[model samples]
Target: MAAEPNETAQVNEIQKEYTRIDKDWLSLHYKISIGMVLFALAVECIMGLILVNTDMLNTTVPKFVFKFILVPSGVNGLCAVIDHMVVKSEKISQTAKIYTVSIINTVICFSLFTAHSAFTVTYYVFVTAIILTTVYASYLVTLSTSVSGLALLVISELFITWDVDKPTIFQSTLRLGNFLIALFIMFSVSMICMVVIHYEKRKNRASIRIEEERITLTKRLKMDELTGIYNRKALHDAMRDLEDCNPQDNYIFGITDIDKFKNINDSWGHQTGDKCLIAFAQLLKSNCIKANVYRYGGDEFCIIFHHTDINEAYETAVLIQDQLKKVEFKEYPELQMTASFGLAQYGSGMNAARLFMSADQALYQAKITRDAIRIHEKEI
Candidate 1:
């Protein structure tokens, strides 16, 4: 039952599409959240600055501070908003983390400016806020973001202390007294938080990878190796699951058997036989809408339908078999393929296994006639 080249290629294309859609969904969520956070931070900064610099403070705003801090922070915030919009449009996830860090850095700028103003005591609040931001970043790219945050902190210190007296030297000289100790404490906390965040991110990533592998393995297990249809094992599970459910009136069961399959293999070799099977499976997959198709065994296939009547199932089978006219083998130009179908519907008491057995018996009757459709009740 090894798949034909065309069928295999089609399956690969479908898998790739599934992966792309999944990636885009995750990217959309992250991008929207990033955009919201950036917008909120920008509003807070713009409004807070305007209020603080206004007569509400009853003091003249420092022009140098406004020029140095407000302009840079606003531009940074705007860049985050633009980056977020780009992510939304392009569905790109690679730059999401970088944009997040830039947004957080704007908040850091606001803190630096506040600390340099009359509220030098707000440095404690800034220290706490920055530590939290760095921890969030550690979850994204632990070591890299942590290093960038450290560099940004250094830059902020330079900006605040520029053109000021030398008394505020908290690093190396420790002239800021206990504030230098507080700085050391903050750095220590940041390092420890980053390590914790790093480990958590590593573990989460490993878990996600394991889960993805498990899903792939589960799919492979259920699929037939040759034809890419559900294998007998999956059929067994599907039947058992149906047995556990409440009986429904609209379920239809069907079986398809390749006509003169042994003669086909003997005449054209096993490779061509495989091509025929792949072609049939591909056809069933395409046309068996609202039904679960399985490779029962050998040259036998099955379709179980939900909410379908016996006549609808029969019409579908006829339509699918008629497509056999178009099936062309490269080596055998004169060969035509056909399948006999057995159709049945479930009653209130019938389990899926019983339902399919009835269909199997009908399929056997169809096989006797060669290329025919037989209702299980008609055979009985």
Candidate 2:
């Protein structure tokens, strides 16, 4: 059987609500991720400049090493800008590509810094150890952190093997101790960042789920149990909406009631009468495509048509009456049912309640006159 008009409308509303929520979530996530990447890049640039100019490091490091560090750091900053632009506007694939480029740039920085021979054997070892720590730290910032970690581990091992015995102020044990401390700090920072990201994602997911549940519950509350159509509450809600409608837009109000409903219940039992009502509601829903159908109460339904003229509304009412002639009520083979329709078109200064009353009075007139449908026209 066809669904009632109100049920279909509710389903459409739910779909629109979910689509809106998902789009908003995706837009927000992109903006946040982009902002974070940009901020990280800005900080890195400032730190690089400070380190290059500071008295403590400027005199100690060679010009070549200084240039090497600055150049790659600049390149990494540029790549971060590109990442921010792409990630803020595109899907996950774009974000993944940006991250991939970022890792490659980081690799270039590691290679440049490690190849320089300015450091004493102990200092070189310490630098290699820092690179390895950074590689592991990268994993916390990125989904592909493990790949970076493995690459750094291999590079560090190779560098250490190549430079086994050069003289330095510090012994190997002290260098090792410093390396361990640096690694511990890097790992701790990365862990903190990862925890924050995970928590935010969890919170967003929970909010989306709660919103979906609320929409579902609201729909159920407004729906009629038998015909799966909008109940009396839904009619009131729609009527309330009419108050703010633009005056230029046409509106049609209709009320429909099943003919001889009580007699059907008395002669064929209430169950069969229910089946008839359900079937008839489906008929109204299927026929009235441009209308909002509501179950006003037992054996009575209402429809409101937005942007409809009097002639079109009357045509629709006639179509619905004709459509009911074909419904095959299987339980009572001899039973035939019809609906009476009353319609009113909106005019200046007509409120929703008054419009509904006008339609209801016309519906009463149709029932009294035994006509299939009646339309209320404003007096000339």
Candidate 3:
């Protein structure tokens, strides 16, 4: 099934974050691999010294050099080359990079197993590599690496002879059976890790859904349902924001009212009056691109202009009044409308309330003339 656009967007955001996390993990893995190689070299050197001193060495000295020294070094060198290629190349897919890391880890662990075949404890390296793959939080990578590790363990059992004490065929069979039990345990751990990762991703998706809903609800609360402009609540919020803003920034506030709006309701009914209000709000929204328009109350509107010229604001008010006069109400073609507007510019040290009061005062003067525009004069 196709995802909804919003859901798709959310998923994209989550994937991007995971990509960043994977990149960091890749870097850490590279650094740790270098350290592990150094440690492995040190252990092999010590083991060689102990075999020589204790006279427990079974293989020729040159064969021992090839097996213990050269083989491990070649494997480590190959890993370094692959790591550099995968990490630096931009063309490699993200899935490929993750798989490369898992493969490298498996190969390194297998190398350790082959180097110390006599030590049954080295078999646990496969299990360790499987567990480390879980940090990527990818079920596919974890499962694939687990299967690969199991395969390598079985191959080592069949082909490679461990230099343990001479034992009967029955004892070797019993040891192989024990290793099979260990494989079962490794597979179980991988399943558990996959389940945990699946649940974590589900939880993250739920969180994203809840946050999206909250933002949608907030927008609805701030919007006017009737006319689709901002509501009085939004205007109040804007006023508070203006109060908190730098006092030196210039602002202009305008309050407007449809002239004789109550008479329109009385003569043509409230429904017709609603139509007029909606049309007026639409005009303001479409024309007043520089300002935020709000439905302050019944038949009244408010605008806040940031850093606008008083003359420009006054001219915009006139244009709105002219535009309103030209609108033909199809329901009542005989009906004509005009709006009165009052504008006030911000002054230093003036609070939002004071600035609002000044615009309201100008609105009162405009109302006296009816269908007029008035600019509040700053007090000397």
Candidate 4:
């Protein structure tokens, strides 16, 4: 058999909640990525300044060369700030920013090669740093599958540069071996980081799916199959929480029961009686503006209005009765049903059990006195 209308509504609500949580997680992740990139740029700038002041290079060459190398690091920082301000899911904009930074770094490396006649050990180190930083940052910003290809190109360039025979301290076999070992280590670390990131993304997606399923199951358990409202158990749990919180403002609890419901069931079939209950539940839900509606057992409904005054609660109850009079039960065109409501407001002496009993007593009075609604008034 197909699920009832109430069950479908509950499922929809749970799905909405899960979607909201997932979006929040993604926003937080993007913010953290932006922060990390900014920090990395700051460290790179400090290292660049230190290199210009040290005895590593002759003053005759000028310090602007070091400054030129740091330009791409500055660009990375600017891109990170721009990415942080944009809305989430702008993947095309993010990809463009990352590619622009990568191209700038490549240009800087080529410029450095042209500036020097021969590739010294320090120059090779600087070029390798630029290539590794470009590849890693591109991978972070894009999560593209072609990052490994770019890394291989970098490694190939390093090997080709080392093959040139020149009178330099970097031409020894021991230095060549060290350079190869360092390249291998960097490649291995980058591959490992990529694997970990991919695994985490998969794990997070699975966890989100599982959480959605659990929320669906919990909704089914707490909701009434017939009335599309909280079951009696759920109602009690909510009342307990309200009682524990017990704010300074007043709260109202109202109980409503269908009048002469058994007579309608006896005259018509039980299916028609079920239809009447469903129609009445929808009426209650429509009338509940700031209150929570609950299915408080068969033929009985409850409403809890938090942070509401007694006068407002009474006015709301009268409005609900007025609306119910206009409902024409389509399934049973000739049939009509009326409801009796009893309301009580919370005060210093009120507890959940006592408040419920007070509403029940007022409801009994409404049924006996032929009144549509009754409010319990304690004598001053």
Candidate 5:
């Protein structure tokens, strides 16, 4: 019983954190990645329209645009478009999407690396490595897993082709060693970032747990111990809030008392008396489903019908009375039990206290004729 609600609350809290992390990551990734695409397009425009025309880099303008600008931009643009769709789809977890994006980025870096000598890609690999570690995950588990996979792919490309570019074994060895050093640097940087991210996630979970405990404490303060319904303090607070509404706003106010409550406690015991109260409280809540019922104290309870009229409130009270007659106590089958109700409505200019006094007076009248319902004489 206790376990179920606690587990559900924990799951709910986790889902909220999951949603926030997903939304934040998607927003950040889309902005930064799209910006990267724009930068690539800018390079395409400048190098093709101006720089290539000046015969710089000894490459044809069209060829340079196709190789350096258009190809990379097209791939990056496609990635941005696909990433947006995937992250927003709801079916895919952001963790999986992060991995997908990391792999794509690694491929992009690999493209730049393979297309040029190792010396030319220092700025590109350094920036990519730093950006790769920024997406947060659990205890560094997810971060490290995804980053290591991408790192391996990039490192694997270093030895992929031993073509004319590396004519000698020593030159190829040096290139591999250089790229290996960069990979090591990237891995070290990622390890530090993951530690920071792990700490932040722990802090977030701790904050949520604190908030949950605070709410539970607040609820306990307002809840009845035996009956599990709103207590006297809660009832008072509710009445205050109700009275804060406009004077003209109508509401039903009522009180209920167990028919011969003291006799049950005296005859059976306080424990049985408590069981009766709990059972009676459950019945009241079910019958008055539209209203809030409070276990005002022993043998006394209150109900509030927000925005309901006198007639409906009275009808509901009658139902509760009828239902009580059919309710059975397993311990004392021969003993039949019933409850009396007194109902009133908030008339114009009536404050919370006055309205409840009217109900209490009617309740007094009902008590005179046990197991009966009475409307306030003023309303009659």
Candidate 6:
């Protein structure tokens, strides 16, 4: 089924907000990638210094320094630069950003492994890299990066013999078996991360749906069931808004009533009276663009004009009264109707109650005249 118009609008707003948040997250991820690379560079330089001080290298000083220190640092810097370029590209998709970042992290980890190939602990750096990819919460990125890093590890193990002695076939098989076990554990970690991400996304969607329903319900409660305009409850809310109005701002209140509306209900029936009320509401809605129209009760309707002078509000009411006279009901063509209006303007220190009572008094005068307009001049 198609969504309601309001629901469609809400969805569009949500999509726009999500796009903004996604961009911010991507930028943060890029900065984190840069920090990680810098951290890797620092670790490499420190380890190289420690190894040099211990005189642990089997090779010459220059060879050890060049292979362990310079090469690893260069790889870190190069990966950081590549990540910078990818994040700066406006046309790149968010998925592409995640893919690039995950690959760069793996490469940095691999370079560190290359420098310390003899150390069994350094081999586990690949596992750490795979686990870090889970930070993006992307299943595809984690899976693909894990598989690629495992493949590189297998290839490196084949040619790069860590020990001085040539391993027998059984020893080689045992090493390969250990690699297989590590691969299984890495895949399991990736699966768990994906499941947690899925659960979080589902929970967020449910919360959003509940919030939308609440907003829709609030709107329904504020609206008149028959005329679909603001109801009496909404008018009370509007009155509360008066306290926040600026002192320089002009506010006009108008109370309008259909003259002898009871006669229409008595002569024609309540259904025709309802139709007349709906038509009057439409007239108010179409004519008073800058005002809020409310169904006060029965045939009495209220209008609160924002930032409008009393004269302007009075003129609008007159125009509505004239137009209401011309409205022809299809069910009862011979019937004619006219409405009375009472207007009052808010003054300094005047509260919403005072303004409404002033308008109501004027409405009483207009009702006595029947099919006329009146204004209450008292501001206090």
Q: Which candidate tops lDDT? A: 3
What clash pairs does model 2 have?
A: 139-145
Q: Rate the local accuracy (lDDT) of all candidates.
A: 0.66, 0.62, 0.80, 0.61, 0.70, 0.77
Give each model's clash number.
0, 1, 0, 0, 0, 0
**lDDT tens digits, residue span 1-380, model 2:** 12234424644665566556644543444344344345534654565567668764534445534444555455545655664565455555533543544454344434433433224232222222223223222333343443453355346534543223322214566555544564455455445545655675666567666666777788899889999878999888888877777756888889989888899899999998888889878887887777778999999999988787888888888887877767776666788778898888777788988989899888988898553788775411
| lDDT for residue 216 in candidate 6, whole number 0-100 | 78
- C-alpha displacement of 374 in model 3, angstroms? 4.0
lDDT of candidate model 1 versus the reference: 0.66
Name model 4 segments beyond 4 Å from true: 1-195, 378-380
- Tell me the lDDT of model 3 at 125: 76
> How high a TM-score does candidate 3 get?
0.74
Mark the regions of model 2 whose C-alpha exceeds 4 Å error after superposition. Answer: 1-62, 65-70, 77-81, 84-141, 153-202, 378-380
Better of 2 and 6 by lDDT: 6
Give the TM-scores of the predictions, in the order they appear: 0.60, 0.68, 0.74, 0.61, 0.76, 0.77
Model 3 off-target regions past 4 Å? 1-35, 77-103, 133-135, 140-171, 247-251, 288-290, 306-329, 370-373, 378-380
Tens-digit lDDT track of model 5 for 1-380: 00013424764877687778766775675566666567656755774677655754565556666766666676667777886787677888766766665555555555444433424353245446345445554544345444654564465464554223433325667656665676666667666767777787787778778777887887789889888888999888888887777655557889999988999899999998888888889988888766888988788999988767788888888888788778787879976678988898777678888989999999999899788888898533
| Superposition error at 363 for model 4 (Å) | 0.8
lDDT of model 3, residue 274: 92
lDDT of 5: 0.70
